[model samples]
Structures are given as structure tokens and as C-alpha cells.
Target: MMHKFLMSVYKEMLLLKRDFGGLVILFIMPLVLIITITLIQDSTFKSIHETKIPVLLVDNDNGQISETVKQNLNESGSFEIVTQIDGKTINEEVAREAVFKGKFQLAIVIPEKLSKDLQLKVNQNVEKILGSFGMEDTASVAQKNIKILPKEVKLYFDPATQLTFKNAVKSAIDKMISKIETQSIYATFQDQLGENDAPLFDQKSFISFKEIVPKVNDKEIMPNSVQHNVPAWALFAIFFVVVPLSINIVKEKSQGTLIRLITNPVPYAVVILGKTATYLIICMIQFFLMVAVGVYLFPYFGLPTLDVNGKLILMSIVALFSGLAAIGFGILLGTIAKTQEQSAPFGATSVVILAAIGGVWVPVFAMPKVMQYVSHVSPMNWGLNAFYDVLLRNGGIGEILPEIILLLLFFLLTTAIAIVYDKKKREV
Candidate 1:
């Protein structure tokens, strides 16, 4: 039985070798695809964090608030504060025109007397609070009942700017302004209570935010485009094996090779296993080559290097199961298809559709809630999750076992259906 299975595997290998050009294309094209996609996506990721956007600033206030805003914007390292254009200082009108005409993506105008009005408002509120607490004279609070109008800090956005970008900028500026207002109120209270008295409260932030990610060997392994794209596109390329594998099987059937194999004394399951093993080998090769490119070649292109370090074994386990699932699907597709034309196009299109809905094109979380639920049906999603578990989450065998089991079950189910379908056809 082992000898017959080995012979079956050898036959498939020989057939693949005969179509050497197609085989080479299968390997080369995926590498090209992964590299191109990683480069494009890495640039986008860098643009959001590493690249500073140039923003027009109209500092009409030129007071404490405006100065603080300018200083903070520069310190944030996300924006380049452009105060002048053509050697002329920009005012609110010029900034507005520049942004509206798309000369700049964003413009921030600090209204005149913003600091003064904000201070007056804070002082009045503080005096009222102190009076209510019996810490200040009620007569003095009643005498200064003048209301202060709110100051407007205008923000202009380019017509072409996306709504998300606009909202992000607005949210950031609003937080900064709120912090400034809170500080001003604190300062006013201190002045009213006399600086000589013990400090009431610390003006600095009591709470802050810090991002936490998975760690390896006591060092943070931040997830980057390389870590993400390598496994994702590798799995995509792995499943793409369905195309050629299905076409080969369909070709065998049309040419009577499958009929000859069926007539042989060897069990039918051995023959199917042989084909599955051959294609699984091809899938593994594709995955490792992609990982090699991500680790070695990506850095040359100014992209982050993929670090597989200790997770190579777990990755291989996921890739092996994913390959089996793909091969099972290919075998089933070839069994059902009548010709190469039917198998080839449908195999390719189905892989693409599976990839699309499976968090390959867009993240499942980013998809609409309905689609997110729908994505669970795609085997590709299971494979991708297993890959992410190993790569990003730094998961071990125990953590990735569920997805691995799903992939294995998918392989078994599809292969069983193919065998049953073929048997029924032969009986007829």
C-alpha cells in the first residue's frame, strides 16, 4: 500500500515537472503579489504615524493657549505647523483659503482673545464656586455678574479630506483645548485661594494611555505590516494551489488517466492521499519562501523584517493543515467539474471569493457586522486566524488548536465528499 501510494505521488510530481513553466509561475507570481501588496500597505501605515502632515496655523491669539497648541503640535511629531507661505505670515483668511483650495489638508485658526476670554470665564466660575463654599464674599460675586461669550477656534479642512481624518484631527484638538481649560480653572482657583496656601490638587494628568502588545523573551514584538502580510498573502497563495491542483485532476480525467488509475488494484484512497501529499508539499514551499522574503528581502525595501524566531514550528503546523484543506477542496472541485475550463476558472474565482470574505482583503472586524458573522463560514478565515494566533498573538500549540482542528476537519469533510461522489459516479 505504501509503495503504491509512493508511486502515485511520484506520478503527480512527474506531471507537475512536465508543466515546469506553470509550476514556476505558481511560485513566482505569489512572491510578486506579496511583495507588491506589502510595499503599498507599509507605506500607508508609515504615512499615518511616521510621516508628519503639514498643517496651516493661523495663530491670531498668539497668547498662552496658541503658543501651547503650537508647541504641543510640534512635540506630537504628527504635524508640521506651517505659519507662513511665500514668506508672508498666514492669517485666518489665508489659512482658510489654502485649506479650502486643497493647498493644505488642514488649517487651525486660534481666535483672538481666546486665552483672555477663557481666563475670564474660568475666574468668574471659580469666584462663584468660592462664594458658594463661603470661602469668598457673596457681595463681590453678585457685583461681577457679567457673562462672557464663548470663543470659537475654527478648523478648516480640504474638500478632498476624508471624514475619518477630519474627525481624528477635530478630536485631538478638542482634547488639547479641554486640557488647557481644565488647567486654566485650576490656576484660577489657586490664585483665588492664595498661592501661599497648600496646593489643592496636581494640575498634571492623573491618568494616561499606553499601548500594550504581545511580547517575546521580555521584549515587545509590535505587530507591523510584514508580520501581517506575510502570513495573510502566504495563506492566499497557499489556497491558490486549488487552481492548478484542480486543473491537473480535470486534465487527468479528460485524458483517461483517472480511469486507468481507478482500474488499478491500488485502493482509491491511496491515490487521493498521494495527490493531497504532493500539493501539500507545494503549499509548504510557497509559505516558507514568502516567510524568507519577508524576513530577508523586506528590510532591503525599507520595510520591517518579519520575525518568526521561535514560532516557525507553529506556523508550519497551521500551514500544513491549511494546505490539506485547500487540497481537499481542489480534489472535490476536480471531481465535480467536467472539464479544465470549468475547474480552472471556478477554482480561481472561488479562492478569490473565499479570500475576500475571509479577512484577506479587509479585516473581519472592519467589515460590516453581518459580513463579520458570514466570514466564519470561510475556511480561509480559519486558516488566517490560526496564522495570526501564531504570528501576532505569539500563541503556542494550545492556543491555536481550535483553528487547526477546524482546518483539519474541513480537509476531512471535503475529501470524504469527493470520495463518496466518485464512488456513486462509478456505480452508475
Candidate 2:
């Protein structure tokens, strides 16, 4: 009796050892995918504009003031300028129409009336603030205060225009103020941005859309970057574990050993239990190796852990459960698949597609609506979100309970399907 159990376990181990290609994929492939995806997947690039914001510039003034504004906007790189000239594409109607096509996020119509507006408003604020200090309200007092944006600098962005895009316009206006000879004019708004003067505009502000810019929560709490990766990338990593597990199970079935075991006194449940147990162990080992190595070595890799010692242990158990769920899924795939050839491609393809939607490779948040909803079904998203809760979110076991339950549910459902499939296919 002992020999039979040992044989089964040993056969599983030997299968792993002999299939070195499998070993490479099971272990190394994940690390490679994680690193590659993490680098390109999230925006780490330090662009002033992290997202490409579209801008439409209508230079109604067509003079030095409008030209300066145009130059400043271009230099800001906060915009992808779509030039409209004369009545053709340059009109407000045309610019507004462009927004519907998803052509531009914002439109800047430089009214033919800009210079006079700046002269009037600049002097008014300058005289009011500087004059309040008991100084004469002279031309010098007005000159000293002309730093704020002129009222003529009108903005007509779609309300849907992002806050960042709106802020970019204001920032560009600020940069323009810095270029003028009068220093005191813009000094009042210095508390906002640019302690150092921006002499001439530079293209360094062009934000690469491929990179990720972090969003700060309302609270003072700022997290490490890994916690950020945990939500998306780790989910991706855990999901792909199924590919290896499925291939492992399909191999056993293909070699005729699974058929031979049915004739033995061992119950079918025991066979499934033993194999599932083996996979669970393999996956847990992998989970720890990734977490440990990621924490100690690849610090950039986002794999979070618990702050409370007990919770950390519980988190590991949760991860173990998630891995088991993945293995259960692999087993189902193996049983239903007529041959390893059929199983291998289908398993790999399923994971690749599902993981993509789950935000392992790219954030599921970034995926379109229907796919995002579909990803909720993927175990990777649940496991990854749970891992995030423990590590990055500083969440407790209670927070991850739903994820744990869902993972187990997936396991039970997949196992039931596999049992039915295996029973029917045994004769074939």
C-alpha cells in the first residue's frame, strides 16, 4: 500500500525532473514575463504629461501675443496641436466638432482680442496688490502686478477633458509668464509651480503614453511601487501557473499511467486528491520563491507581504489555496483534452488571453469594458487582488475571504467537471 502511494508521488516528481523544458517554463518563464511586462506594462517614464493629451490651437489673434501663446503651448508639449487656419478647420465650430471624433481633448481659441485684454487685466491686479501696500498706483505699480493669466486666455475643453489636461494648460500659461522681462508680474502665483524660472520652453515635457504615472490617494498615505504592481502584475503571475500544472497532468494521462491506476484498489478520489496535492505543493513552493526572491532581490517586482506576522502566514496559506485552485483548473483541462497536443495549446492560449484581460500583462483597469467584466471570472485577478490586499493594501484575512472562497469554488467546479470528463473518456 505504501509502495503504491510512493510510486505515484515519485512518478509525478520524475515527470517534472525529466521534462526540463517544463521546469524552465514553470519557474523561469514567470520571472521573465513579470520583468518584461512590469517594465513596459506600467508607466514608469518620467514625462511631465504621462498621458498624451490632445490640444487644438486656434490663433485668432495671429499677432505676437497669439504667436507667443502658440509657441509656449507647443514648447509645453502638453498638447498634440491640431492647427486650424482661417475659416476652414480653425473655426470654433470645427474644433468643437473634432472632440466628437476623439480627435482632441481640448481647444484653445486665441480670440482676435488678446493683447488689449492682457494690458487691462494685468494692470488692474498689479495696481490692486502692490498699491495696497501704501505705494502709489502708478504705471510701475500696475507693471509690477501683471503676472496672472489674462482673461482673454479662454479655455473651452470638453467637461470630459481630464483634470491633468486642464492643469497642463494652466501650467503652460505659467511658463509663458516666466519668459517676459517683468519679474514681479507672475511672482504672486509662485506658490503654485516652478520655483526656478523656465527661461525658454523645452520639449522635455512630452509625456510618453506607454509609461505609468502614479495617482495619489486623498489621504496622506503613499505606498511603495511594488504595492502598485501587486494589483496587476502579480495577478498575472499567479494565473499563468495553471499552464505548467495542466501540462503536468496531461502528461500523466497521455503516458497510460492514469488508466492503469483506475484498476488498482485506490479510489478515483484518492488519485485525484494525490495529484491535486502534488500540484498544490509545487505551486506553493513557487509562490514563496517568487515572493522571497522578489522582496530580497528584485525589489522593483511588486509582490506584497503582510505586516502582521500572523496575517503574513495566513496570506501564504491563501496563496497556497489559490495555487490549488489553479491546479484544479489544469486538471479539468487535462481530462477534457483528448491528447497532450490538444491540451497544451488550449491551456496556454486560455491563460494568455485570460491573463491579458486580468491585467497581468496590462492592467485590467486599462482593458475595455466587456473584457474587464470577463476577467472577473479569471482566478488570476482574484488571487492577484488578494495578494495585493495582504501586501500593498495592508488588508487582513477578512478582506481576502471572498477571493479565497471564489478560488475554492473554482477548484470544486473544475474538479467536478474533470471527474465527469475523466470517467467518460477512460474507455477511449
Candidate 3:
């Protein structure tokens, strides 16, 4: 039995060697895909945290408020405030035009008399408080009847800006103005009471937030583009083996190779096992090559390095089960398909559909609730979640076992169906 299985494996190896160019393409294409995707996404990630967006600032007031806004924005390190363009200072009209033309994503127009009007408003409110307490001077009570109109600060956004970005900018500006108003009120009260008096309250924040990332051996291991793309595209490439594997089976049937093997004394299950072992090895090689690129090559391109650290064994285990699932699916496809035309396109399209719904192109959490539930049926989703568990979540064998078992069962079920289908066809 062992000898017959080895011979079957050797025959498949010979067939693969005969088509050397196809074998090379299988390895190279996925590496190219992984590198290209990682490069594109890494820049997007950096732009959010490291790149500064240029914004037009029209300081019509040029008062304390405008100066404070510019200073605060600069300190945040997120915006580059442009007060001038082409050697000319920008006004509200020019800022609006630039933003509308999409030259800048955002523009801020600080209205004239903002500082003076804000101070006047604070003064009136303080006097009103004093009058309600019966503590205002007789002369000050007469001045409280003067009404001050509210000042407006205008924000112009590019038409292409997302609504979330608009809301975030608005919230930030509102918070800044609220803080400035509170401080001005406090200062006015100090002058009214006595300059030598202690502060009314501390201005420092009492609450704060800090992000806690997953750690391994006391070192933080944050997920990055490379970590995500390597496993995802690798699994994609692994499942893509179905196309060639199915086509090869169809070719063997057409050429009478499979018929000859079935007529021999060797069991059909051994032949299937032989094919499975050969293709599983190919899938593992594809996975490790992708990991090697992430670990060794990504850093040279200024992308974050993929860190396997102590999880190599667990990752390999997941890859092995994933490969088996893909192999079983290939066997079923090849067994049912009548010709290469039927197997090739169907195999490729099914893999693509599975990948799309499997949280490969987008995260499952980002999908609509209905789609999220639908994604659970895809084998690729199972493999991807298992990979993420080992790479990002610091999961051990116990944590990954459920997914591993699912993949193994998927392999068995598909292989059984293929065997039954082949048997029924032979009897017919």
C-alpha cells in the first residue's frame, strides 16, 4: 500500500515537473500580490498617524483667539496651518476658494472682533451673576443692559471630505473654543474678586485614556499591514491551488491516467491520499515564502516587519490544516468536473467568491450584520481567523483548536463526497 501511494505521489511530481513554468508562476504570483498590497496599505496607515495634512487658515481677527488656535493646532502635530499662498496672505474668500478647489482639505476663518466680542460676552455674564447675588456696584448694574451679538467662526471643507472627518474637525474646534471661553470667564472673575485670591479650580484634566496592546514576553506586538497581508494573501494563494489541482485531475482523466490507476489493485483512497500529500506540501511552501518576505523584505521598503516570534509552530499548524481543507475542496471540484474548461474557471471563481465573503478583502467586523453572519460559512474565513489568532492575539494551541478542527472536518467531508461521487459514476 505504501509503495503504491509513493508511486502515485512520484507520478504527480513528474507531471508537475513537466510543467515547470506553471509551478514557478504558482510561487511568484502570490509573493508579488502580497508585496504590492502591503506597500499600498502601509502608506495609508502611516498617513493617518504620521503625515500632516495642510490646511488653510484665514485669520481675519488676528486676535488672541486666532493665535491660540494656530498654536494649539501646531502642537497637535496633525495639521500644517497655511496662512499664505504664493507669497500672498490668504483671506476668507481666498481660503474658501482653495478649499473648494480641493487644494486644501479644510479651511478655518476666524471672524473679525472674535476676541473682543467673546470678552464682552463673558463680562456681561459675570455682571449678571453679580446682580443676581445683589453684589454688583450701582454703576455696573446700568451697563448690564447693553446686548452683544454672538460671533461666528466659519469652517469650509473640501467637497471630497468624508462626513466623519467633518464631524471630527467640528468637535475639536468646538472643544477648543469652549476651553478658551471658560478660561476667559475665570480671568474676569479673578479681576472682579481680587488678583491675590487663589485659583477657583484646577484646569488640568482628571481623566485620560491609554491604549493597551497585546504583549508577548513583555514586549508589545502590534498588528501591521505586513502581518495582515502575509497570512491573508498566502491563504488566498493556498486555496488558489484548487484551480491547478482540479485541472490536473481533469487532464489525467482525459488522458486515461486515472482510469489506468483505478483498474490497478491499489485502493482509490491511497491515490487520493497521495495527491493530498503532494499538494499540501506545495501550500505550506507558499505560506512560508510569504512569511519570509514579510519578515526579511518588508523592512527594506519602510514597512513594518512581520514578527512570528514564538508562534511559528502554531502558525504552521494552522497553515497545515488550512492546506488540507483547500486540498479536499480541490479533490471534490476535480472529481465532479468533466473537463478542464469546467474545472478551471469554476475553481478560480469559487475561490474568489469565498475570499470576498471571507474577511480577506475587508474585515468581518466592518461588514453589515447579515454579511457578517454569511461570512461564517466560508472556509477562507475560518482559516483567516485562525491565522489572526496566532499572529495578532497571541493564541496558543488551545485557542486555535476550534478552527483547526473545523478545517480538518471540512477536509474529511469534502474528500468523502468526492469518493462517493467517483464510486457512483463508476457504477453507472
CA-lDDT, candidates in order = 0.90, 0.65, 0.90
lDDT of 1: 0.90
Better of 1 and 2 by TM-score: 1
Candidates in order: C-alpha RMSD to true structure: 2.9, 11.0, 2.8
TM-score of each: 0.89, 0.61, 0.89
Candidate 3 wrongly placed segments (more than 4 Å): 44-49, 136-154, 159-168, 192-196
Model 3, span 275-391: residue lDDT tens: 999999999999999889989999999999888888889999999999999999999999999999999999999999999999989889988999999999998999999999988
Model 1, stretches more than 4 Å misplaced?
43-49, 91-103, 133-147, 158-164, 196-198, 210-212, 264-268
Candidate 2 vs candidate 3: the lDDT winner is 3
**Candidate 2 segments exceeding 4 Å error:** 1-6, 41-220, 230-234, 299-311
Model 2 scores what on Cα lDDT?
0.65
lDDT of 2 at 77: 60
Worst 10 residues of 3 by lDDT: 42-51
